[model samples]
Every structure is written in structure tokens, then in C-alpha cells.
Target: MPAKWVRTFAERRPGVDVELVDCAAAEAAALVRSGTVDAALGRPGVNAEPDLALIRLYDEVPVVVVPKGHVLTAADELTCADLADESCLLPLDDVLGWDARPGTQLSHRPETTADAVELVAAGLGVLVVPMSLARLHHRRDLTFRPLVDGPAAPVGLWWSEPTSELVDEFIGVLRGRKAGSSRGTREPVAKRSAKEKAAARRERLEAAGKVPPRKPKGAGEPGARRRRGGR
Candidate 1:
């Protein structure tokens, strides 16, 4: 979605070169702060530097991934206690900051979420992660169910403070603002035609007893009957 947003906004404003950079969350934030990149898109966790600003983009709920025939498949959401006796496949370096639950059994830590996902596919153990990661590493033999009591990860856009024109334009796009307009721009007031003015005058005249008011059309009226039959 981030890539798509960049592409759409760039197309709307030609001559702007929008580059997509893939890096660790912290590194991405650093690059944005250093002006190496115009803006960074990732989870929110950056040191509060003087020249940086962060704006939230979206949030994703954490979930548990299990084998197709696992017992947890029958549940809509599972608590940490639900997996008390089960061996969980935990990643050594999880960005979600997940720690082992009290008294829960854990399998040997894998190097990455991809490794944990592969282990889960092999029926080794269950794995927990954000819904986006589950979808990212979706396998035919595995399925995911939300972890009811789990924490959510917030995704956001970060840029250097005292933004440039290009960065400001990109921020506007991310915030769903239109070009050449202020944030939360309102629709233009519509002009009333001469016929509408005449109609309004006629209604005012009728209201003042200068002319008899016409009866409002009911469902049985000719126009209403025609509309119903057309449908």
C-alpha cells in the first residue's frame, strides 16, 4: 500500500522522483532524519532527534499462525494461556518486541520470522506475529488466527523537521490532502442557477399567501408511479 500510494501521488505530480527504500525500521528513520531519503515508512520506534518528525500511518493487530489442522484453528482468537502446553516458534530478532509468556513452553529460537513460519509449516510449533507478516509469509499448509490479548503494532511515516516542498507534498498525499490546497480543504460553494432562484421566489410567494401552494406528490402520483415502474 505504501508503494502504491507513492506511485499514485507521483503520477499526479510529474517530475518528482519517488524512491522506495527497504531497510530496518531504525535505519529507515535515521535515513529520513539525515535527509538521505525524503520520508520513511515503517513501524514507529525512533530516537527523538531534534530534526525529525513522525506521523502515524496505520496500525496492525498481532496474530498467531498455526498449521492447517491445529487445535487453535477452531478458535477466532486465542490467549497466551491457550498455548500454555504448546511449543511456540519464537524468532530471535522480532521487531514486535514479543517476550515469552509466563510458564509457556517455547521451542528453540529461529533467526527470523521466515524461519519460524517455515517451522510452523513443518508442524514444529505455532508462531505469533502481526497480521501483515502472516499475510506476507502465507503458506498453503498454514493459517493464522488473531491473538485476542496481544498488542498491536503501529505503522507510520517519518520525515525530517522543517520539511521541504517535496516532503510537504508527500506528507499531504499521505494525509489524503489534495495538491494546491490546504489540509482538510472544503468543497467549493455551488452557484445557484436562474431557474433555481425563480423556483425559490415562487415558493416564498406561495408561503406568503400570494399564490395557492401546490400539493406535494405522493407515491400514487404520476411521476412517482413512472419512477417505480422504471425501476
Candidate 2:
């Protein structure tokens, strides 16, 4: 979604300069607070902070990555109890943060999700994470299934409050606002002229691959109203 929003922002503001910063999920809010970045797409954690605005983007479903032919794969989905006997490898950057983590806990924690996935492929243990992360470090020897009882990974767009116009424009893009949408504008919509409204409507229709509906027969002609009787 971030990539899509970036493309949308670029297409909308072709003359504006754009840059993307890659950072740890937990550090996204800090980056915004420190003004190191204008905005960031990060996992939820910014609500308690002041002078910050965040828009919840999405909730990623949790999945467990396992080696191919694992017994857990026999079933479509596994519950916490299903993993009771198997080792569960939690990476240092684990996002789920499940309090009552399913499966047996191992002393050795992988440094990152990719390493956890490698261990799973080696039959060392199963690793649970958001579906997107599993897909990120995908391997041929590994497969994943939805962890039905697992927690969701909620992500959002984080930025400082009282944003500048440029940051607001990017925020609008992340919020799926139309290119011409007036964000936080106090002007009344009546400010637009009838011709301008019509043109805008036409543009929207064109973008949607729709043709404007034709007027009823003689509808705009003077005295063209249909008679009540057959006469």
C-alpha cells in the first residue's frame, strides 16, 4: 500500500521531489517525532504521543511459516494449541507481540524474520509473523498458513501534527484522496462555478471509463413537457 500511495503521490504531484526512508517498524514514529522524516508508514504505537498525527492504514493477518510437509500443514489452519509441542522461534524484530505465544519457546532467538524463516526451513522451529513479512522473506522450502488465533499487525501513516502543505499532500495520497481534493480547506464547495463543476464531473467520469448520460428526449427544449393524455 505504501508503494501504491507513493506512485499515486508522484503521479499527482509530478513536480514535487519525493524520497523514501527505510527503517525499523518500531522506529517509524520516532523518525517522524525527530523530524528525520516528514512521514512514515509504521505499525501502530503513536497514539499516546502529542504533536503527532497518524492514520491507521491496514491490519495484516498473522501467519506461521513452516517447512514443507510439516504436520501442521495437514490442517488448513492451526490454533495456539496445535503448536504446543513444536518449538516457536521469535525473531528480535517480531511484530505480533503475542502475550500468550503458542508453541514451545526456544532459548535462541533469530536476529530477524528472514533468519527465523531459515530456521523453520531447517526444521529447527516454526515462526509466526504478519503475512506480509512471511511473503517478504519467502523461500522455496517454506510455506505458511494463516494463524487464526494470532493478533493482527496494524499499520498506519505517521507524521507530526500541524503539517506543511507538502506533508499534507502526501498524507492525502496515503488516505486515497483524489488528486484535486481540497484537504482541510475551509472554503465552501459553492465557491466553484457551474462550468467548473461540470468539467470536474466529466473528468471523474472519464477516469472511471464512463460516458455522461444523455438527456431525456427534448428535455431541455422549451414547452417540451409530455402531455398527460394521448392527445
Candidate 3:
């Protein structure tokens, strides 16, 4: 979506390219510090590199995933105590802090959010994770409910102190800033007027031999005489 936004924004300006990279939070921060990548996106507070600047993008609430017919399916929000007797499936990395559950019996530890979701669908146990991860690994037979008092995960955009214009443009888009916002280094291209667009279309058609050449206008009609002389 960021790349798509960059492309749309660049349509009028031209000469812009957006590249997407995937790596661990630490690795991404290292890339930014080394100037390999202009910017990086990752979980907030995950990378504390000295030279990298972190910009908070948004916060995601943690949630609990259960099977469709499970007793908690109708719940709007769940608490850690609500899962006391239930076996909770947690990811191996524990990045979302699922292991920090106050009083729950963890029956299994899956390697990834995807694995946890699958376990939940198979009735192995319930899984606690960030709302985005739950949605990412959503299963047809499984549903999620927000954890009212659970930890909130913050997502952030990171970049070196001195970033390039292109990186700034991407950051602006991620922050939902307008095209002309100062936070974005690249200016939006001015839209062509209807008359100007039609004139350009006619020129293209004429060049393609699908339309006749337009008649020259009067000398006083702007630069018509100069254009005619050049032709």
C-alpha cells in the first residue's frame, strides 16, 4: 500500500521508485544506520540504535483468538483470567508478550503466529496476539476478541538522522499526511487542466497519424506564430 501510494503520488511528478524490504527489526535498524536503506518500519521500542530516529505510526491492541463455536466467541473483550483454565498457544519468539500472561496454563508454544492460529482452529488452545497478527493469520473457523487490559503494541517508522527526499516522501504517506505537507519532501504534481489534457491527447493522436494536423492560430494567439515558424 505504501508503494502504491508512492506511485500514485509520483504520477504527476515522475521519476520516483519505491522499494519494499523485509527483515528483522534489528537488521532493519542496522540497514538504516549503514545507509543501505533510507527508512525502515518495525515494532516500536524494539530497536534502540543510537543513530536511528523512530517515529510512532500507530498502536495495535492485543487480542485473543478462539474457535468459532468456542464459549468466548461472543465476547467483545477478554481478560487474562478468562483464559485461566484454557490452554493458551503462544508464539516461539514471544515478541507480543504473550508469555507475560498473568495466570494462564500455556499448553503449547507455536513457532509463529500462523502456527498459533492453526492450533487455535484445531481446538488445541487459545492464542493471544496483537490484533494485526490475528487478522493476518485469520482462519475461517476462528475468531478474535480484543483484550481490554492487554499490552498495546506500537508500530513505528525508523530512519537515519539524514534521510533522502524519497524516504521522507514515504514517511509522509505512512503518517497519513497530505500530498503538500511539509513533512513530505516530494511535492505533488499539479493536475492538468481539462483543456491542457485534451490538447495533449490531440497532439498524440496527430503524431500517431490518427488525426489531421490542427490549423495555425492568429499571431496574437499566444505563441502560435512562433510554434508555426518552428514547424
User: In order, what lDDT does every prediction score?
Assistant: 0.76, 0.81, 0.73
What tens-digit string does per-residue lDDT give for candidate 1 at 1-231? Answer: 888788867766677788787776557777875678888876763233445677888778888889998988998888878888778776875667655552344658898889999988888888878898899889999999988777777788877777776677678888887554653122334558999999999999999999998776653555543445564
- Writing each residue's lDDT as its tens digit, candidate 3 over 17-94 gives 566776654477778777777887777644456667888877788888889989987678788778778787767755
Query: Candidate 2, clashing residue pairs?
Result: none
Worst 10 residues of 2 by lDDT: 182-191
lDDT of 1: 0.76
Judged by whole-model lDDT over C-alpha atoms, candidate 3 comes out at 0.73
Displacement of the residue 173 alpha carbon in candidate 2, Å: 1.7
Q: Which stretches of candidate 1 lie over 4 Å from their true place?
A: 45-51, 99-107, 183-231
Candidate 1 clashing pairs, residues 3+ apart or interchain: none
State which candidate, 1 or 2, has the greater TM-score: 2
Error of 2 at 186 (Å): 13
Kindly give the stretch of ten consecutive residues in candidate 3 with the minimal lDDT sum. Answer: 218-227
Q: Tens-digit lDDT track for model 2 on 31-60?
A: 888899999877773234455677888899
Whose TM-score is greatest here?
Answer: 2
Candidates sorted by lDDT, best first: 2, 1, 3
